[model samples]
Target: MLILLLAAPATAQPAPVIYLDQGWSKEDREWYYQVSQGSTALSYDLFLNLEVATGQDLFRSDANSDRYGLITQAANPRNNPDGLPIGLAKTVVTEGRSKGTYVGITCAACHNTQLNFKGKRIRVDGGVGNTFDMMAYVQALDDALQATLADSAKFGRLAGRLKASSPEAKTDLRKRFEREAARVHEYRTRTLASAITWGPARIDAIAMIVNRLTATLTGIPENTSTPLAPTKPPFLWNAPQATWTQWRGVQQDPIQRNLTETMGVFLDVDLQSKSPSEGLFDSNAAISNLQQIENLLTRLAPPQWPEEVFGKIDRKKAEAGKALFISICADCHNAWPYTWTEPNKHGKRFLLVGLVPQSYVGTDKGQFDALRPYAITGQLSDQLPPPLKGEKVIPTDQLYEALQEAVLAKALSKLKLTDAQAADLHGYREFPLPPKPMAVYKAAPRDGVWATPPFLHNGSVPNLYELLLPASERTKKFYVGREFDPVKVGLDTRSGTFLLDTTLRGNSNAGHSFEDGPLGNGVIGPRLSDEQRWAIIEYLKSIPEQAGRVTPFGGPPASPAR
Candidate 1:
């Protein structure tokens, strides 16, 4: 019997396993399975919620629902007038609209991977495999949505009903609807073109336009309400370090600026210049929303490893790579297991790096402008009439009063400004410099450096090997390499190999290869040899992956695919 049992099929009953708590153990697997199922469901729900919130369905008719009476309602006489329903109005009023949904194409749309025979993963990261032409997708979607919205018969019937109810209201409603529809159509066209032509710079411009337009239409502030506008699904990985309360060291003043200038409100009212007593805006509501967003983000999980796909690292190469990193890259490009005590506060700081000078320009301008409405007018909004050119200038005491009135008048449109708003926007804040020279600047902490290619803030460099070259060599006018093409560096071939003219020096705004004096100064090591450079790259590829935090209950992680 023992021999037979030993030779029994693999499916034979297994030996009894010990459990710390018998009752709990029996239910644990079921509980885990349930949790996993629940997570999957939550992920789906979050995806749909974000899709609706961001207005992504604007282009894709199949993903949209008529049940919500969105585009369909515009065709109904009771809702729309002037033979058209307002596009943005319907989108804002309608729950779950994504503004830039077409932009949020899936990862699979680009990065194609296959499981090898040995259950290993083979993935391509070149332009062929990692191509995400959002511009083309946007154009396609815009064309489709415009065609759908142009059904005149449906629009006329809706307009007729509105006119029947009230003539005056009908005209205004019709006009607003038409205007809004045109705006939406125009927005799609312009945004698609910009997304295709410009790269990172256009993102901010598009965001600004969206904020302004949304504010004008909704009567809601842009920073706070704009996120509520439809947006493309953003990547789930690398939730901005600034977003988390736990990762406080990475927090900088510019982040505060982003919250106020871009995000539309302050996370902490104390951080705002305005006092609580001054009821200029409801800081509490803004804070609550931020907290909600943070809570949601906290639960976002890392992408799951696909089944039958495992990675193998060259241990010898990795060890050598580590040495290279410590010697060559450790200064600025700090590695994992990072921890340091903050100098100012007694708090523990992690992932802190030196501040680059150029980054500060934006923050400076924002601060200067914040004081403008107050400095020029002495109030938050304009409410007073402009002083006559010849009118006696008010005394210093009365100047404050005059400014306050001006702010109120400006708010009410009672006052008109003679000059454009001040342009003293501040740049990003500076952090403590690293002890030694590091290869890169402004590179944020991510999963393994190797797996995440197209390195650098703007993703100017493609791989670690290219980045290993000293600034002197890499900064040459026409220098080219396997991945670091001059064209991609925002330069024409005639501009020579160096993306930026390091020879001309002093903030030329051509490429990023300026002298490392203020931002890039500090010597940690000598230039690397070709073999050493490749070895470092190999080491970077070998670093263990860090676990990402799971998306929370309300803020579920986005789908792995899209």
Candidate 2:
């Protein structure tokens, strides 16, 4: 009963799913999918019975469809016990006024990826869920909830499913539904209204989280900033072992990264409370679960090229491409036998990811601009430290850092966790380097990168072939949510939902050219010929070996050799 959103005849056979060995057991995968990070999306019961605007079951309707990039899972007793797709979790609220079994978003929602290859589905556990359109999903949910509330028949249908046919029961059900519906409406308005069409596989995640922390949580309408810059969620395979995470390279600590993401997704918190006694900074963040997730991510490995499924690699072409990659791409993408530096207490070495300057890389600057300082004389001032407390303006990055710490601290305090326990929760403070706003984008190791599509931090480029072309020659617009093109090593831009117009703000595809031009502003090397481009693409599919040691690039020299 697994339904893939891909278009096909009713009599056509179901596409077989090929799950890559990304180093997760059945239990591990299940736990990863269901573990609650305390992000409430909707009440579980409501989500189960809610219908689309057309009166079709929401989960089965085109509105909740996988064609929009959100995977819809069928009922599975073990893999997906609740029958919700990866990244959606069910949890009971312990502290909030909306205390009940709620369906929330988890890390799997964005990180889990499924690629269609000639009617076959290839699942990449820790890869980017390039198909899920966060904005559209929220909007669809809002529409469904609104439809149910407005239509008496729809309301009656939902109530009947929940066994609330009695007059008093129906009244209570309506009240609960109204509250959640209002909540969903507000969220949709805040994130979707006037916001950039973050079509698929991208979001102004930091901006959204800051909006919630500064404006919504503190009830300071003036603190709000429209989410303008959307970036693709980074794949999680090697993230836990990296020196920094996120496209901006602004986060280091794994636990803090998860906490920030949880908040962005919808962690329930009361940061508006003016006094400590009023539960100021209190939240229902799943602190322990966050820690566990961090631990699990450490074991997650990037999916290697599956030759059996995706066809064999051309070693001859890959060999030639390796030389070309070393000459042009190695400095930024970092060829393996990587220099693993920054050894923590357990002697775990981290791969220092390169952070290329934005001006040079010449990708969209919206992400950097989003972190710039802004006026924030809001209720958050009371929670800030002495110097920032009285300041009229605060850098968004600094403000978010402070608030993340405060929220985590508050959550930890409520749990009565010991100092040692807290340290454990925070990944033993291994990645202690504080986050700072930098006008740079991270250059992650390109191992399983061939699997991630819609290239560039903003996801402006649709494929590696186009990415290698001069920015001016790149596709002006293309559709996402299409099947994977193994030959081109990216999305099949010919078909899909969400047409990405590169000319749009924050969607510029005008950098990282491999053509002959000025060294700066993204033209990094001599023009790569068509053969060269194809060779490199082939090499990427092969994913060549790493040396035991190599010098780092775009970062400080590797911790003086440990």
Candidate 3:
């Protein structure tokens, strides 16, 4: 019998997760998955009881989950005992009337990554989540809610889990479900469901946050604008050590960036209240939690290449590529062990990332242009401070920043943090720096960039090899939410659920060409041969080993001669 059982076909075990050395310990990594940023998606019990469109368990592997590229995580005692996927955090609502454990997505949802190469799963902590489709996830949630409401059997199963056996209990459960359903539906229709589908790894974060504040929270439908610019989430590994963060290099204060992010992810707030004392600026934005996350990020070293899994780097090719980097790439993407620095309160130095003009880099101006437009904010205009206070219309970027700062300032006031404590929390910034407008996108260091695929600010380019080619020669449309191509050093575009049509407005993969062409229109460098392209990629793979502390003069010049 034992021999017969052994001979029988066994179930295939899941591919073991291989984590890269990105500074976080096992405990730290687990904690990162569970820590709350105060953005509530749904009540914890509700999420647990929720069913998919097919009436299957929400957490079960299904077509929707597969299509959405949602990572399946196993339960562990240290954190995520409920087996929530990476970035999904459940926390009790401390201040809201809806006081219960609620499921919310943390920074990890968009920043953490897991790539498949020959069936091996390699996780990159703080790397770009190039697969998770935010739109599809929201749509699935909406579908589940609607399906449960329409099907009595589904509701019964959900009610049973919540112990709502009685008619009154069932009625209350239905009402609670309805409320959540409505919220999800509204968010999906208003913000996420766009004409240009934000496939995997791309979202118009700024538009969504602004709309959430000005339109949804302020009850001003006029303030809502269709989210037009969907860009991939920026990696967080070196973000804490950067003087200017975000793709735009507009955010100087780290906590402000965190607060903006949490708010975008559904940070519950009482922004509609007419009176200040009536919790007008009060929010569930967890400043302490944001601070914790920021601190952890400071130690997050970029993931180095796993030569065992990804194949060994060619040292000769890397040496040749290093020469090309100094001449062609160093100006925009600083040299490793970044020499240029600025002072910080933590006694650590922050790199001064290059801010290349949008016209100069010429890779999809949609993201930069998205923030430049003005919007007609309704009654919230009255709540604005100074200058634009009485104006009905204001710049979208400015308005959102003002509102975010106000809410954050109030949240800090409640904490009663000492100046020194607050400075520490702000990544050493003594006071919050108000966001400023810049027509440029950041050109940050690419130490472990080989691990991050779908290159460029808008993630239009698939790999380093393709990125080196002329823009016209690049893949016009390709699939995302698939495996990594170790050789190409980018996403496996051969198969995926989301088809990224680069021909679309915001989705254009144009600009940032390396071909021999006219100077402007993103033709930044001399064209390279296929060998040179591969050589550069080879060097990029070895960068993680070479990163850390080099003299400014010892490295290549910071800017190009152009």
- The prediction achieving the highest lDDT against the true structure is 3
Clashing pairs in 2: 69-131, 87-109, 336-546, 337-546, 337-547, 516-527
C-alpha TM-scores of all predictions: 0.43, 0.91, 0.92
A best-first ranking of the candidates according to their lDDT comes to: 3, 2, 1
Better-scoring candidate (lDDT), 1 or 3: 3
Give, for candidate 1, the lowest lDDT window spanning 10 residues. Answer: 33-42
lDDT for every model?
0.29, 0.76, 0.78
lDDT of 2 by residue, 12-125 (tens): 456756666666665787688778888887888899889987656665343366646766555567645656767777878865655778888888888888888887887777
Tens digit of per-residue lDDT, candidate 1, span 382-488: 32335522333323223333332222222323224333221011111133422322122243333333433333333333435545554444433332111222112
After superposition, candidate 2 runs with Cα above 4 Å error: 1-13, 59-63, 342-346, 371-375, 390-393, 416-420, 430-437, 544-562
Residues 209-242 of candidate 3: C-alpha lDDT, one tens digit per residue: 8888777777776767788788988887667766
Clashes (backbone N, CA, C under 3 Å), per candidate, total: 65, 6, 0
